[model samples]
Target: MKRQRAFFHTLRLPRFRRITLPLLLLLVFTATSYSLVGRQTATVPLPGLVMIDAGHGGYDPGVMSNGILEKDITLAIAKQLQAALQARGIPTAMTRDSDIDYADSGTKGSSSKRSDLNKRLELTEIQQATVFVSLHINNSTLATRGGAEVFYSEQNEGTAELAAAVQSELHKIPQMSKRDAKPGKYYLLRNQEIPSLIVECGYLNIADERARLNTADYQKKLAEAIANGLDSWLQKNK
Candidate 1:
């Protein structure tokens, strides 16, 4: 028992207590903080800045199906996507973080929708974003049509390759339809000088897909897939 007594005596010394107590408290605090946040802090910085746009907010809901608003869903997914990207050490910015729009009523001769779009585009320029990803939910008259689709603007040279990379990653999701990335002429994409694309996450009219889109777990999965795609593209182009 002499060895045990000596060990206990050393632990009780002022110098030992001074160092060990603070370290113990720090360990506890870090554990608590990590548990509360549910995400580890990111340290390394990725190359490009990504601008995420949650399409259609406030008065413009985009599409509504089975009591689900496209604006709400897009915002939810966009926030999740931002988190996912940040977790991977990628820099990200969002056009809207809440249930609001950038439309200015005082702007003469411009429609509210046009004003909102202009504001979103202007923010990208102001932020110097290298890539833009607009998130939206698809609507279809035929409920059977479901699955995520990616469309890139031909205005930028490498946009098609980026879209294809994202689409390929999205296709890996279980039960996700394998859709080819196509060229789109969307105003947001057309106006952007950087690589840009619109991602139609899923069909809101489809019963199963709509149900999945509404759930947090599925939204997280979708965000992870998108993040993975972006990471892949960045790795190749970097």
Candidate 2:
């Protein structure tokens, strides 16, 4: 029994954590709150609810430029983000996964964007979601405009903070440039009660950025960055 206690005491020592077993464990659950031994003891934030909106779908190309569709990029990033979050054990729901359309008018797609967003809010209320993130792409006449932008609604200060958290992490990646978090009028951010953010991954007008956004590798990096941001925010909040 004393030997077991001595072993526990050794684990409690910081020096022991640098040893082989502990170091390997640290690699297994990188960035999680718990040290090497935390895998089973602590809960990963992934179990919490997050709504991932893939902007545009079906016939709606969203913001189209240079033959690239905003819908496609958005879905790609959203799905990638979903995979990243799930890897960390975060539960996520997608607003749309396929090339379908949800319009701002008419009976078929006519549900007011506001109403549709409000319905998402209702779902969050029921689901107790931790956050809301909408994926989008930017477009401008001049290719000079480039970089990722994060947007939050005016209502939730927490949402803005979360957006900033994500923006900060995204900037850490090698090629990504940081832009300020703007207050957007987007429906998902405005209508949802939970902390919400809209990520403008890049500008479609810029050939380099557009091409970068098209690659699976870049999309994976974006997803990882997003996951890191969410994880950081959750650690602070939780």
- lDDT of each residue in 55-102, candidate 1, tens digit only: 888767889988899999998989898888777666787877777776
lDDT of each: 0.77, 0.69
Question: Which stretches of candidate 2 lie above 4 Å from their native place?
Answer: 1-47, 103-126
Model 2 residue 3 distance off true place after TM-score fit, in angstroms: 68
Model 1 ranges off by over 4 Å: 1-46, 106-110
Q: What residue pairs are clashing in model 1? A: none
The clash count for each model shown is: 0, 7
RMSD of each: 15.4, 13.3
The residue pairs that clash in candidate 2, if any, are 46-89, 46-90, 57-100, 58-99, 58-100, 105-110, 106-110
Candidate 2 has an lDDT of 0.69
How many clashes does the backbone of model 1 have? 0
**What is the C-alpha local distance difference test score of candidate 1?**
0.77
